[model samples]
Each structure stands twice: as C-alpha cells, then as structure tokens.
Target: EFIIESRDIVGNQRVIGDDAFVVEVEGPSKPQVSVQDRDDGTYLVSYNVQRTGTYHVRVSLDGHQIAGSPFTAQFHPGLVMAVRCTGVGRGLTRAYAGENARFTIESRDTHRNKTTSGKKPFVVTIRGILQVQVHALEGDNGEFHYSYRTPRAGVYFVGVLLDGVDIGGSPFKLTVDPGPAHANGCSASGAGITGGYTMVETFFTIYSRDYYGNQRTTGGDVFSVEIGGTASADMRMRDNENGTYSVAYTPMIGGDYFISVMMDGVHIQGSPFNIASDPMPRESYLEMYRSMEPTFKEKMEKMLLGGDVTGVKDRKKANSRRGKEAAQQKSWVLNIKLLDANRLIPKDTTVDGTYGTGLVQSSDPYVVFTMGSESVRSTTVLKDLNPTWNEEMKLPVENRLEKLKVEVMDEDLQDEDDSMGTAQVSLTDLVIGVPKMVTVKLKELNEV
Candidate 1:
C-alpha cells in the first residue's frame, strides 16, 4: 500500500480539494490495483500479487506521474508453517554409508501455497546407529536443501523442524547398506600367518570389509593365496559363508616363505605374513640311526624321554678309552651324542604365536648336524624354551673332515627356519673308544 499528498501550482497545500489519480502495477505479472482519492488532496493505492517477487507501481495525476510515483514494491509469500512443508527427491530415502545424502524441502504457508524463507528457519538432525546434526540451505526459488553422511550401515531417521515446530511427518526413516569393498578396508589374520612348519599344514583367516571399514555381512569373495620360498609349496582358501575366509598351506623345505593374499586381485591388509620353518624330518635321517649298537641305542631312547644318560657304562658299548691311534684301527662306527641346549633365544609369534590371546607362543627347537652331503636332523621339540635331544647317531668314519657342523634352529609352521646359532665340534682331539660330553656354545665364532 502507498499514500500520496498533492499541492497546488503555487506550492500551496490544499486542505480539501478534488484531484484525478490513476494507479498502475507491473512486475513478473500484472497485479490488480485500486486507487482512492479522498477529495482532501491525498490518494491511497493498494495491490494484490500472485507470485513472490518485486513489483513496480506507477501513480499518476492527470497526465504526469506524481513525485517518486514510479515506485518499487517487494513481494513475498505468506506466513509459512511446519505442517505444510515437505521434502523431495530420492536421496532423502536411501544412500550409502560413506557417500553424501542430499534432499530438498518445499516450505509452504498455512494455505499450502509455496513460500519464501528468511534465514535459518528450519532445524534438521539424524539419529539411529549414529547421531548427527544437519544444516539446510534456503534458495530464492523457495527450496530448502539438506545433506548428510555417516560411517555405519543401518536404519536411521531424519527429523526436520520449521520455526521450532515439527513438520507434518517430523521424522523420516532411511535405510543404509554396506558399500563396495576397498583394499584399505579388507584384513587378514590367524596362526598360520604368524609362522609355519616345513612339510606341515598351517592356517589363517581373512576378513572382507566395505568402503566404510565394516566387515561385509555376506561372503563369496574370491581370494588368492601365494606362498614362495621353496619350489614345492601349496596354499588353499575357503569361504565360511560370512565375511571371513580360511587359508591353509604346506611348505616342502625349511626356509623363509613369503605369503601374499589378495581379494579380487587387490591386496588385503597385512597380505604377506611370513614363516620360519624348522628343519623337516626326512626318512634318510631316520635310516641313519638304524645301524647303531643296541646298548648305545637303548641309552639314547632313555635320554630322549628326559631320562638320565649314563654314557658308555658297559664295555659292550665301547672297547676302552682309545686315543687317535684307534682311528687307524678302522672303527667304522663313529658316534656323536646330542645333549640338551640351555638358554636358547626365544622367537616370538611362532606356531605357538597364539600368545596372550588363547594363542600359545615360543619356539619349536631342534638340532641339525651337517657334514658335506651327509646331514642328520634330530626330532623337533614343540614349544620348548630349553630342549633335550640326548640321542646318539653313528657317522661314517671319514678321514677327510676333522669337525662336525652343528646348528641350533627354531622351527616355524609358516616361514623359514631361524638359526638360533651354530658351532663346529672338533673331532680330531676325541678318544675313539670314549663317550664324552662336549659343551658347544653356538654363536658367531670365527673358524680357526
């Protein structure tokens, strides 16, 4: 509405008089306007618009527009209420957990007619697996847009309020599902991964995760397992119908084995867990013990069972205490006795690696006596810090070698055998017919 006051040509104000007043309105669309002359030198103007916009009003007297008669009038929608407002678009109903979810709302008046908003007229929030606040942006086109995102997959509710009042459908329900898997999201674990044994089966588990870092609820993901170290190694994988997978492998020799696990050609977290395998027992080493004298053999069995070793108590096992001269007499039976080791270094995360958690830890230890092409390996003592192998095996009397290479190693079910230490025992100074106990300290000692 606008008011206009008129004066005479002499600039004298007229208290009561008649004047011809015409009014016109123009804008996005012409509006209906009315003009009333009070016959007292004043005029009143009013207009009604159908759209929300700025409208131009022109008030003229006779043939010319009155002072500032071409005026600007801003128009806006009527009072808006919460019950008439509503959201639009697909994003409001569903979206992935890690991606943005966007939707828009149309604010309306009590009569359900489109309306414009001032600043910060609506409050939004989300609740369910997670609680979060939402910010809405108002557009001149009369739209209130809102967006949000979450890291968990589950059902959620979106609540909207206008002018401190809840909307007609105040809280809307939304369903979020786990997104596609990513290399950074997947993971692997288990006993086999920590370590393994040679010629023995080892196992582990793999977990498939989604973009949001949550394990997927279903399975059927293809995983490839590769083991490297010796030429003969085999790995197997299985799906447990859930997000987890089972893996198993066997090593042919004692060495460091590198394992790589992949899902759909992508590396899982901690893909290559390694293994330090202990020397594998072979039939040839067992065959070497079959020819020893029964008296010496009977004592060895007692020692292996953690029994007392009364070495060469009877003359039946040895002639007398002969010196190096006896070597020339051709005693084909050359015996080497293995005693118990003490204070050996402990290697963590072995087959016993199930430490602290239901998992057992410690090294499976053993001894290997290597001489040229002839190597004899003793039995593996599982999960032992200090192990005893009082067994005596016969070696062929060869004049060529003066020392025997003795190595103490820790056996793993997964990777290569770890050398605890090694020592060379001097065979030249020993008495031929005497049973002796030689304490060989294995370390990085240089050969003389």
Candidate 2:
C-alpha cells in the first residue's frame, strides 16, 4: 500500500483533486489492485499478489509518468509456509567432531518462492551428546545461514525450524566422525606398567581419545612403545578396536624400567612411565630358565655362571644356598649300563642359614656301592632335598652270583659319615651279556 500527494507548480499542496491517476503492476502473474481518491488531492494504492517474483509498480498522471514513475518490488511467501524451506551445505551430510558445522537455509513459500519479510524465527538444533548451540545470520540476500558445533561423534539428527514450524527437512541426519587422537588425551594402564614382576609375562592397556576428550570408537590408531633400563625389552601391542590397546612385555632381567608410550609420534598422557620390577623368586630359577635352553643342567649352569642369582645374599659363606641347589644337585642324565645316583635327602631346612647358624638339621648325603671286594663312593650333595645325580658308573663284575650292597650316608663335618639307609642286591640269577637293572628295598629308609 502506498499514498501519493499532488502539488502545484509553486510546490504548494493542492486543496482539491484535479488530474486523473493511473496505477499499473507488471509481473509474471496478475494481482488484485485498487486506487482510491481522498478528495484532498491524495490517492491510495493497494495491491496483493498471489505468486512470488519481482514486479514493477507504475504510477502515471494524465497519461504522463509521475516524478517517480516506476518502483521494483519483490513478492515472497509468508512465514506460515516454513515447511517449504530448504537447506543445503556439507554439514547436512557429515562433519568432523570438535569442529564447526555450517549450512544455509532458503526461506520459501508453498510454491518454493524466496521470502523477503517476516521475523524469521528460525531455530536450528542438532541432537548430540552435548547441548549444541546454533547461530543464524541473515545474508544481504534472502538466504539464512546457520552454524553449530559439537565434540562428540555419532549419527545426530539436525532440525531446522521457522516460526515454530519445521522446515522441509527438519530432522537432518548428520554423521560425525572422530578427529585424530590427541597426545594429552591418550593414557596407559595395566599391571605390566604399574605392578610389574621380573622375568614374568606382564601386560598393559592404552586408551585413545580425541582433543575434545571423547573416546574414539574405531581402531587404526598407530602407537610406539619402548622399554628401557636394566629390564629393557620389546613391547607388543594389540589393538582392541575400541580406542583401547593391549601391550605385552616380559622383564628378562629385573631392575628399573622406563616405558614410553607414543601416539602419532607424540608422547601420550603419561609417556615414559617409570616402574621398578622386583627380581623373580629364588626357588623359581629352574622354571624360569628351563625355556632358555634345551637341557635342564645347561640352563642352570648358564644362569649360575652368569651370576643371574636373585633373592637374599650373604657375602661371607663359601657355599651359598643357590650354589648348593644347583651345583650339589648333580642333575645329570643317566646312560644305559651305568649306576645313577639320582637324588638324596634335602640339606636346606625351611629356616634360614643353611651354613650352620646354630641349627644342623639337614646334611650332605652321597651314594656308596660295595661291588665285588671294593667299595666306591660318589660325591656328596649339600642342602637341596630334591637332588639330581644322573651318571654312568661301571665296575668290574667277576662273580655273577655275588651280591652287591648300596648305601646312602650323610657326611658329618666333625665326625664319621652316618648311614642314612642301605639297599641290598643279589645278582645270583642275573642273565649274562644283557644289561640288568636291579630293584632293591632299603633296610632303614623312609621315602624322602
């Protein structure tokens, strides 16, 4: 609607109407228009268009164009047609988590015509873990641009509203992907790193997170871990595919170890973790070194020779408990046609100080064989109750009907060797040329 006032050549307002006024609208479609004279030389023009487009409104007086002859006007749909609004941008498809997301909206009517008037009243929202805030701006043109952001990744529903009404695509499905893992957000955990024991299989776990402190759901995150110091060794990593990884490593030699965890060539939350691994127990040396070599005695000798001893130490004794367990054990493999003294009674008592600190319960025991007219004695074993003396001992056998006597005795450092027990064997009916294995019962021996 518009009002026009007539004037005289002297620029004075006219008191009464004089000339005829003409109003015409030119556009793609026709519209309802009307002109009214107010009797005071003023005219009123009102027009309403059906469709939306650019139109020219012309005003003329007495077959001649007025001072401002024509005016350009744009017709847009009303705000009631918000459901016809359309949105377009990359944010509608996918977005990167912890980053800005943007898109544009074109306000339209039922016929999809651009709108130029209204309060807008646009409400944009994204359904995510966090309450996202949206910012909308009106461009110089009739387009509406909206932006929003969130730190979480997932399939989120986005809504665009205008005047309390949903837009064409109100619930936009937006897929968010996790960003790269951040150093400060990644962390490590587990027994291998915090509560590690030497010469034992230990493992740890690593968790990966993004810059926004959100856990990544998928794998493909690369990491580098290195163990250093006296317990240095290679660490193995297993990807759990859920932002967590398992790291495995064994401390061959116990001491201090430094564990470094890195993600994407950068240090994680607690990189270079320090841990002190305690040495393995003294009794477990056999089990620990058995896998190191094929033969049991070779592994023991190697461990003993390398001074890889653990547990308590007493620098004064000429024969330590460990030396007694390994050296005096005499655990050799037995060959055919040989007399093998496998093991005897244990020497070390449960109480400490096997070197005689007032207690003399255990002893050093050996095997003695009385064959023919001569008697022979093997070396004595110290404190280890479970001894190994596998060997091949050959003696002259003159009489096949003669009996052989075998005895076990404990050596007394201050007196004569005491007899623990004795086994009596008689070879009177033995077969010649063929090797013979005799079994005998000891007279005074209980199972050790």
Candidate 3:
C-alpha cells in the first residue's frame, strides 16, 4: 500500500480529488491496482502481486512528478503457485506399446522459487482402455520422474497427484501406437456351396496378419487359391482393404473339390479344404432305419445275453467307436506355461479425437484355454513381456481330434480386451499319463 499527501501553495493542506492524482505501476507480470481518494488531502494506493520481481510505482499530480516521483519495491518467493510438467521429454504425448515413456514435473512458488525440499510423494496413475501402474524414479523433490508401459492400444489418462490433491493440469492424455507389422498366419472362412450347377458363384474370405498380431492390409497380391478335384472353377481374389481378402469362384463341374489357399508363398492353416460341387443326395429316414435294423437286432440280443452290446462286428468301426468313447470318458491333464512373447504385435484404438498407438511397456497379459465349447482363463500377469504361469489343468477331451486353443490376451477395463496371439495343439500329439512341457508359439489372427 502507498500513501500520498497534497499541500496548497500557501502552505495550507488541500484535499486531493480523485481526478487530481494518478498512479501507475509496472512489474514483471501484470498486477492488479486500485486507488482511493481521502477527504484529508491524502491518497491510498494498493496493488496485488503475482510473480516475484521488482515493481515500479509512479505518482503524478496535475501532470507533474510528486515528491517521491517513482518508488521501487521487490518481492521474494512466496507460497506454492503452480506445478507443471517440464524439461526434456516432459510433454511426450505419444508412444508405442512395449516402449518406455517418461516425463518430468517441477513446482514453483509465487516468488519463482523452486520448491524441491520435502519428500511429498507424487502419486501417478494411468487410466484409459486399461488401468496401469506408474512408478516415479528414485528421489522426490520439486522435480519428479514418471515412467510406464501400456499393453493395449487406446487413449490413456495420466494423472499426477501432489500432497493427495491434483495440481493444475493433473491429468495428461497420450496416444499409444501398435508396433510394426509382424503377421505370421492366415485364416479362411466362407459359405459352403451345396450341389450348385456349373457357373454357380461361391465366395470365401481370408484374414492375414503378422506374428505380433498386426494385420496385413497391403501387399495382398501374393495371395493365391487353387481348386483341384472334380470341380474346375475360375477363381478371382479381391482385397478387402482391412486385412482380409474375398475369393469368388464359379464351379464348372459337379463333384468334390479341394480348395487350397496360400499367402506370401506359404500355405495357410486348414488349407486344401474339401467342398462338394454337387450336394450329396439325402437318404430317406425309413431307408436309413431299415439299413440299421440288423445291427440294432444284434446289439439287442447281445445286451439280453449279458454280453458287450457296444461292440461292433466290423473291427475298424468298433475301434473308431471305442476311441471316441474313451476320449470322452478319460480326462487329460495339461501343464501349460506362458513363458514369453517375441516381437508381439501392438494393439491400439481411438478416443476423444486422439489416435493412441503402440504397445504398453509392461502388458498385463493372461491366457485362455479353449477346447470344444468350454474355456478357462489363467490369472493375469501385470506389466511383463515375459510372463510365466506354470499352471496345470484337467480337461475332458470329447473328441480326440479336437484342437486345444490357447489364446493370449491383455486385460483392460474401459474397452474390450486385446488378444496377443494364439496357438492350437492337438490331443493326439500328446502322450496320455505323461506331463509334456510344450512351448506353444503364439501366432497372429490370420497366421498359420
């Protein structure tokens, strides 16, 4: 606060009118100033300071300098003013999954003094498609360090907490990008053709991707299809532009046909799929019942005689039936271990007009085991590229030929979970009553 007094030329004090005097102030930052005219020929001047610096206050009466003319005042560091993220890599708002992301923060007081003395724990959290844990680098001062890795792709909110309260701009947003393409397999599916005439059109779809789960959208010219057997079909392939392809063909003859698909010179899984150009004729229910009567009668007689009625006269048929029943009755024990992943495909999604790409540094990964229609999931491993879960499970194999599907997925809260990779193992390849330590290499969606 500043005060000023006025006097008349006759040495008598005079009252200063509001318009008779003017005050001007200059500082490093904009300052709020106010003045009041007193009835006793005095003036009161006040101003609010924002930053620490020297201020110049000038007084003038009727366009002439007052006794003091100009006054100078200095302000030192005061209370905490604002905290912000600063320094190198401070505002890095984007990163790839499995890649490290870092940022630094600094706090200052109103007087522009660095407040780096206390041990005020800085709490940091990331929330988005998934929730992740963030750790500050050792040492806590006005300057702080934060780092994290996200496994899934999506927008994430990075929040910083000081003294259990959020500072200005507490939460920062970042985009995560999935990594480079590493599609390792392909899958094919479509509508089956039944007894169609010559020149009848049928179509199938194929999906291709890398081992890291990245889809293949371009360079699809390498995809090829071959139809063998009785059907001589003209095949044409079309790129769907979304990591998939459509193959449309017209059959020239009626009979059985074998369709083989290849991508990048490698045969995909389930290649050489068999299809019928001409649908097989259906048998009447009465005729089928009549044909089974002799076998039914033989089984009924054996049952009444207290013999094994499930046995069949044909040795091959009996063996096949017994194998199926045994598979259904016996439970297989499997010990699965999720060791690690190599060059995993990054996953990503968009949120709030921002594109988030890349994989999180430490992916919270889990595994799901699927056989037939039943599925079981393993416990999640947080923030680890190489997760280990040596777990044992007992499952009933209803079909000996059914493949056991193992899918690796990352856990997320805000959106659908992401898949890392998948591998299929046949029960026939395992030895019963023996524990096999199998290393199942994961593959992308369309990878073989």
- The residue-by-residue lDDT of candidate 1 on 89-194, one tens digit each, is 6667787878777888788766565775564367887887789556565466568788787888876777788878878676776777777767678887665776
TM-score of every prediction relative to native: 0.42, 0.48, 0.39
Ranking by lDDT: 1, 2, 3
Tens digit of lDDT per residue, candidate 3, span 145-226?
7788776655687777666766556567676665433324567765532224344466776766554453354444456789
Compare candidates 1 and 3 on lDDT and give the better one.
1
Candidate with top lDDT is 1
Top candidate when judged by TM-score against the true structure: 2
- How many angstroms is residue 69 displaced in model 1 relative to the true structure, after the best TM-score fit? 32
Better of 1 and 2 by lDDT: 1
RMSD vs true structure, all candidates: 21.7, 28.0, 14.9
Worst 10 residues of 3 by lDDT: 280-289
CA deviation > 4 Å runs, candidate 2: 1-80, 116-119, 282-294, 297-448
Name the TM-score of candidate 1. Answer: 0.42
**Per-prediction tally of clashes:** 22, 4, 33
Candidate 3 C-alpha error for residue 365, in Å: 28
